[model samples]
Target: MPRYGFIAIDDRGREYRAVDEAMSEAALEGRLRKAGHWVAKAWEIRPMLQKGGLFGGSIRVPTRPLTEFFLQLSMQLKAGIPVLTALSGEAGESPHPGLKRVVQDLSERVQSGQTLSEAMAAHPKAFPRVVVNLTKAGEASGNLAETCNRIRLYMEWQERIMADMRQALTYPAFVLVCALAFVFIVFTLLIPRFAKLLAELNVPLPLLTQIMMRTSDFFVHNWAGVLGGVAATWAGLHFGTRLSPGFALLVDRAKLKIPVIGGLWCMIGMARFAQNLGVMYGAGIALPEALGMVAGLTGNRVLEKSITELRQAVTEGRQMHSVMGSHPIFSKLVSQMIAVGETTGSLATALENVSDYYNEVLPRQIKRMFSLLEPLMIVGLVGFVGMVALSIFLPIVSLLNIR
Candidate 1:
């Protein structure tokens, strides 16, 4: 019996997390559901294989295909198509091969008389627990079509935020990489040529020229060592976080403490947190359970831990705004809005407002971030080129004066 860790909400909306022995993951979920627990997450306490980051993760259908699948499924079901008919059509019509295969399997399972959610549960990688959880809520509410539509909309919004982040960072990352390559070129090739020319001139070098020439010589002689050291350090940092939760948590904290970018990261995490929690809560999930689902979605372990504790606190009947207010990581805007939402008993709408507010803030911050980064990178590149040219020129001028 493998021990599984699970977070679930009882019918009374109380959250619980415990370790229980189960024969399989599905058995744990089934047992909890049988006991009237709405499970947010469940997994073997220690997986035989560790998977983290995109490459190590299980094969997942891309968001575009999944989004389209949900949209089509929602429409067909609303038009009164049978689950079997809808899934069968989707299996054939899905543009992505990976999703098509998953849909085909889903169709077969639906044909075998399992409910759509139950069938989807069997392929957790293809249909995430969130998707299955939302579908189950849909089934329970007898509004499967509406729930699926909402899921599609949420996915679209989340994907757009991610695409925007990538678009903003992509050019900066490219420029940084190019600048580093140019620096390497100067140290190994261009600077060395100047160094040799100066040496043949046999003139006294300025202090700056002396320093740059020595740096070039060291790099030329130890290029292998320099590259190896960088590669080794990077690999160590990358794998260390994956291997140790404590270190990863520290790193997550450090990420939020970094300058201009740190504030941006916090806003993004908060927006995601509010949006996910809102969507789940709006779909009829309890707050504790919705928080359980959202804990991992914030993209920051520190925030994840805070939300996890918040889930526990809410489960214990504490006010969510009170808990959020105490955490410095949470913005006043979020805490204040949450307090208003709680007072008015429209917490879900409040959450959506929080998310909306951040969505608007994100684009402005991203543009500001770009404005800072672009000028800094340009200055850095120009500085490097100027230093190299000055270092080379100073020595030549001295050599001519001596002659």
Candidate 2:
């Protein structure tokens, strides 16, 4: 389907402009009319800048962490409790200030007759597109309770997978931070004190020790510059993603090329895509629509582009398996499973199976990767510290032998 940017009016001549999805210009016009908007002008916009900026900030606000909130929401909806009442309950129990306030507002909106999906869409910063789409599908299918349950389960899986990956990286990350701190201590405090004593004694330092002294002095003198460089680098990456889609794609591509971490990163993204797509499909979303919704879940630009291309191919009546097979990023197993699902009309189940498989495999893989990384990091840091110590002490030993 083609995306169009349309400026339109209602029967009473109220004007509005927005971007919409449709198969053609004529189709979009029909849709607008059906929605009670009379089309005045319509045109397609080039998707050159396809994605939004870095989501929020470094402190990740967990959007769907409260597993119990969803569970209760499902139970309430199942018991014929109104959507507003359910949202209010969720709001009352949510501990996070941001989420609590948003839920409260959402409850008010729902009470005012907006659908749950509509209420949620108002908070795009809080709710992901997949969640919003699932809510809509649930409302359309009259199975809000089941949809909420599925979404809750999906989010639980996501959080667990992420927690596992974070755990795997935790030890290595801590080691790296400690290693940097050790280096800083040596350069700033220990080395300078040693240099003072050596200067007082008028001892000629070894070449390695001389080099270390010079490096430490430079670092000590230019500490502010180092901090500024780090800050600048972060800002550049942040604004670059916001201002340039091409640059963002390059960064995302680089992420996939990273060493051991890269593979795990890719797996995490694939799991998210599979799980969200499965949930949508199971909730009776059409294949193309499901693909569109799933695209938002992948944090990588290259993968998002692949999904967009896949959606286009499917829109043209191309086989899902063939479209996906053309992309080298997708594994043979995933492609084959999709093929099987398409043939048997069970893509939902196939997607669910893929999600389940990764849910089981990724945590274990992440743990193993971390376990290997920790020792390697410790050994490297110790070797570095030992070399520096030896370089400084060996010259003293030589001077003693001369005496």
Candidate 3:
């Protein structure tokens, strides 16, 4: 599908610019007319950039328990029930208001002669790429219910991994906030009082004390400028990435170079890619198409490039295991498993197993990270606060001796 950027006039003669996907210019015009807009100008969008907001932008959706939905859909379909009827029933009984609305809209579109995959694609935020691709593949292969079950299992595993990651991150975030607050209090309240006492005593200060005083003076004098600079830098990076793909790719590359967290990020992306690829392949999709979809879903430009290479290698008849082994980000164990799967003609199952392996290991890794982080945070807090406290108290003791 090609994306067209159009300038159109509504019934009230108000002009609006919108970008939409269509098969051709005629279809694009027809869509605009159906939406009650008169096309004035239209141009094709040559390239689409990968972008997301802090809160995931339009992609962020409310929490939904997809497990029950999938299980019900699978059971109903497997029982020879119609897709439209199943969706309509689920739409009515859905516990999540957001998901219910989505199902209602999907049911309506699907009932109105649209394919199930097409209906799902319209709700990009609600249905991720893996779900939509699997739906498309399932529809093609006449095994939609089975595909849904597989997707549900994968989603459940993903949800658990995400929960573990959040748990790991939360403690460090709390400690960081506490440390910042402590520093602020010391500089704003304690340091000023100490400076006054030292001034009254008319005594020469120690080098360490002088250095601390200068640091406080600089912060106090330029706090607004420092904060503004930070805000501007953040805004610049955010907006710059939106304007240029090259910058986004650069940042993605840099992100992979970061230690500990970077390794975790790489693994998570690879796991997600393998899982989605397995879903697609298991649903009878071609390897090329599965690799393409996996690339889009990875959300890392560097990783995407690697997957693209893998796709090209598959297109060229290169072995999947060999291609995977060439990438440093992929583990040797995973590559070996791929080799075995390829030789045994069970690549999909192998990929699924690889994903399962990561899914099982990730939580333990997160737990270990949190275990280390908790004590590290406590030690950091104590050390920093103790140092500041000592700096404050030592000056007071010296001033009292003069008294």
Candidate 4:
């Protein structure tokens, strides 16, 4: 649908200006009028030239602001404020420009006789599919405030998990950067000087020194090729993941099998799926529908495929726990718990307990892995620099003895 820029006067005598998508000018005017606004003027909007293709057009609103928005909206709705009033207040009070714009647009949409979920569907960036679906469910069940609180809690949990992952990687990333710098200095500066001195002395070089010199020479002469190869490899992977679903699936599968971080990745995915399923289920979404949403939340194609299969099984009237038990992606404990939940008709609580287990385990696992990683990285760095120094000095000592 084409977007339109419109000027309209509301029933309250306030003029509103914004862009909205509609089929035509008539539709735009009709929508505004139905929203209790008199259309002053409306015109089609041509999209602005985006700087980056496919990825660059929109500003990224941070998760914190969004979480806070949901939380506040929940509180307001719980306090019996009307949806439109809560949205307008949120838009007016928000400090985030992107969020404020989204809220303002949502408010206008709501004022125009659209439901909160319908308004949110227009802004997928600010309101994800899960949020929109849950909101719709809440609206249907007349429990939108409770759903909003669930969304808020999910966002907060997601944010904290991401923060923990970043923190765990920070020290290792710093160490790797320092090690790379040390290697670069040794190869580009120190090794060349040693090579020149050895050449001047006209002595036979040791195997270690010869190898070091040759490696340094390769880097010094072919640095552009090295950098280009790295860049090309990254670009290839980036585009491949975007363009090929099978390749992306393969990559995601590989991520689950990676050395130290694989378990962490798997745990995180499971945790998110469980949490999403629990929240959506608690909000009164059907099991199969919640499973479908959880599939998307897993963020891993392997798990997503399994979850999708489980959804299909459920849709076919099969037992969910039985199907899930057949999948290796789910643990025996999880399967049993889910079976119990199924038996007791409390799958939401079971899933929440599963999510809590993963959430608790993930942080400790990350910390332990990084603790081991730091010492291993330190040892490797020291060993590498020591070997390089020995390679250079042994040749010098041998030349002196010959003299």
Root-mean-square deviation (CA) per prediction:
9.6, 9.9, 9.0, 4.8
TM-score of each: 0.83, 0.80, 0.81, 0.87
Better of 1 and 3 by TM-score: 1
Error of 3 at 230 (Å): 1.7
Cα distance off (Å), candidate 1, residue 308: 1.1
lDDT scores in order = 0.84, 0.81, 0.79, 0.86
Give the Å error, residue 15, model 3: 38
Q: Rate residue 100 of model 3 by lDDT.
A: 75
Q: Candidate 1, 168: how far from true, in Å? A: 1.4
**Model 2 misplacement above 4 A:** 1-66, 82-104
lDDT tens readout by residue for model 1, 188-281: 8888888787778678889999899899889989989998999999898799889998988999999999998898888888888988887788
Better of 3 and 4 by TM-score: 4
Off by over 4 Å in 1: 1-59
For model 2, residues 1-403, the per-residue Cα lDDT tens digits are 4556667888788876566778888998987789788988776532321123234311123735446667888999999997877787888888777667667656655554468887677666666778888989999999989999998998888778777767777778889999999999999998988888888888878889998899889889999998999999999999999899999999999999999988877887888788888889898788898998788778888888999899999989998889888998788889999899989987888888888887778788788878888899989998989978897887799779778
Query: In model 3, what is the error at residue 102, expressed in angstroms?
Result: 2.0
Sliding window of 10 residues with minimal summed lDDT for model 1: 45-54
Deviation from native of the Cα of residue 40 in model 2, angstroms: 38
